[model samples]
Target: MTYRMLALSIDGTLLRSNSRLSRQTKDAIEYVKEKGVYITLATERPFPAAKKIAKALKLDNVLITHDGGFIASDVDEPLLSRKLHEDKTFHIAEILENYKCHIRLLHEQFSIGNKVRQKNQLIARMTLGIQDPLYYPVTFVDSICEHLMENPVAPPKIQAQFFSAEEAQAASMELQKEVPSIDTIVRGERLEIVPKGISKARGVQVVANHLGISLEQVVAIGAGVNDIDMITQAGLGVAMGNSPEELKASADWITRSNDMHGVAYMVKEVFRKQLKVNI
Candidate 1:
């Protein structure tokens, strides 16, 4: 198939385990762009965190950030953005407060969180290490739910980090039952909540439509459960070697793990082959 675009997940797909980009991956991306293949990042990260990587890669396409809740480039207005209702945001925060978790409410440009819990401070530190954008802004309130109740503004996404994946899953199940109007995805020790029917796949579809391409002409590569929809929805779906077994089961192909320069290998082995045939 003559693929026109590549949608990549940031955390475990493009970055190495240390959360840094490798020269091999950067060179591969440049090669693909030179060949006229569009590249964009599909991540659960907010725009400020994701934009830094996009700019480093020099990708000009509209980015699918906030787990597909926000789509835009550095220059253009968001093509699509799905924000949670004010009531739902507060209710979700209320439910999460029962657990030992660090909660964050994400907006297009800034995020708000309450005082970090002692137990979950490690999770917060880990997240800080990974999402280390120089200019990403965050505010700390005393009570996230109460603050949102008083302020009453819709947010693009709500995220919670737990000490264990089990706690994250338990909270996710409860959110699903109590808050059916939102979509909850448990990725490792973190749980991400967004408006119903919003996902990376949906975000990629919006970008495809804007580019006048069909789903069958797009390629998606990811290493997380949040990426499953786009992996299955894209014309070609690739899972990284470090991806969980479930994601690997759903992938059309499995490349090397992110640390091993899997993305570059996939581009040279899979995408390059197709491009060569087309030529």
Candidate 2:
């Protein structure tokens, strides 16, 4: 089968356990690009966070970020964007405060989050890779709900980190019940909320159309439950070995864990005849 496009999920799929890219992975991507394959990142992160990884990979192609709610390579110009209106944002924030979860709103370039400093409070997944103060400035507010009440923010999505998975699950359920039009994705103790119909599947389809390719020519690799849609929609879907059994069950193949450089292993295996295993 000839694949024209390769879509990768960040975090556990593209990066290692320590949140770093490997030399082997870089070489594999270069090999595939030389093979005339297009590469892009499909992630739940905002553009700034995902763009940092793209810079490491040296890929300037359009990226699918914010769980498919936003897509663009350059910050100023966006090929596509889907964000929650301010009213919905405020309502979601109101619901989240009940659980005492650390909440953050994800914009295309900037970030607004609550100043959560307490025991067992999640630090928003190691700050969620937004370290560039000049490029991706993050604001830590005292109360996100109050901030929204005073000012409106149109964000692609919102993320909440809980102290326990049970709390996360409960929050997800309540949010879904209250806002039936929204979508909730639970990863361990983190709960990611996005507007309805916004998904990686939508992102992939948009990128495919932008690249003028068919879905059958795309290979999706992911490790998170939020990634299920794209993984299921692609011609070839792969799950990392460290992923949950349910996520693995959705994949057409299972590769090594993130620590073992699963993406490099899988890519090399697929194009072994054309690309060498060793860098």
Candidate 3:
């Protein structure tokens, strides 16, 4: 067997502790590249945050980000994108407000919020550290709310993220009742909401089509609930040993935990075990 494309989820799947890529992960990716496989990263991170990782692998290729709301290449050109309906965006804000959910409206990383929570502050730090071009500070918390209230126009929601898992699940359930036309998932503890019919799997299809590779030739690996769609859709889904039970169940194979070089192990598995396409 042989795989023509590999679509990898970031966060728990690729990065190790501290949101940084390990030398081990880098070397594994580099080795795969050397073996002439087309590697494309699929991430919920915006292009700016995703680019650095792709660059580290010296992979000048296209990748997906913002769940399935955005796709771009090594350069800043858009390949595909989708936005939530404006009415739905406003409706979600209204519903979540009643639940006292701390929310942020993201349009390519330009976030508007009632207040800047610790999580937003952390994301800002990470964005700045990576020098992400899509990153921008819209306004102070109070000003942002004031502007939204006065404008009365729904912003294009590239991403709407909740700061907590419990709150997100609650909000997701509520939104499902009022408006089910949205794609929602959990990235780590954060709840991510995107336009309906958009997801990492859809993103994978786009990249696969571009490469002329069938879905059966793609392998996706992940560790969180957010990766469920990607894991199930890929031909051979591999879960990290540390992944949640539900996620592990969705995967066709499981490997060592991330801290134990799970990615390296899986890379070797593809070449030496599953595909037997010796590197």
How many clashes (backbone N, Cα, C below 3 Å) per candidate?
Answer: 0, 0, 0
Once superposed on the true structure, which residue ranges of model 2 sit more than 4 Å away at CA?
117-135, 273-279
Per-model C-alpha lDDT, please?
Answer: 0.84, 0.84, 0.70
In candidate 1, how many Å is residue 236 off? 1.6
Global fold similarity of model 1 (TM-score): 0.89
After TM-score superposition, the amount by which residue 14's alpha carbon in candidate 3 deviates from its true location, in angstroms, is 1.3
After superposition, candidate 3 runs with Cα above 4 Å error: 74-76, 116-138, 143-145, 149-166, 186-189, 272-279
Expressed as tens digits, the lDDT of each residue in 177-246 for candidate 2 is: 9876789988778889998999988999999998788898789999888778798999899899888888
Reference-based lDDT, residue 6, model 3: 78
Looking at candidate 1, the ten consecutive residues that score lowest on lDDT are: 119-128
Task: Give TM-scores for every candidate, taking all chains together and pairing residue i with residue i.
Answer: 0.89, 0.89, 0.80
lDDT of 3 by residue, 1-279 (tens): 578777887777788766777888899888777776778888777666677778877877888887767787833467886877666777777776665344566665455655434634533322222223344554435433345556543432433345456776777777777887776665444556787887788898998887788888888888877788887888889899889999998999998888888999999877654333422
Cα lDDT over the full model 3: 0.70
TM-score of candidate 2 on Cα atoms, chains taken together: 0.89
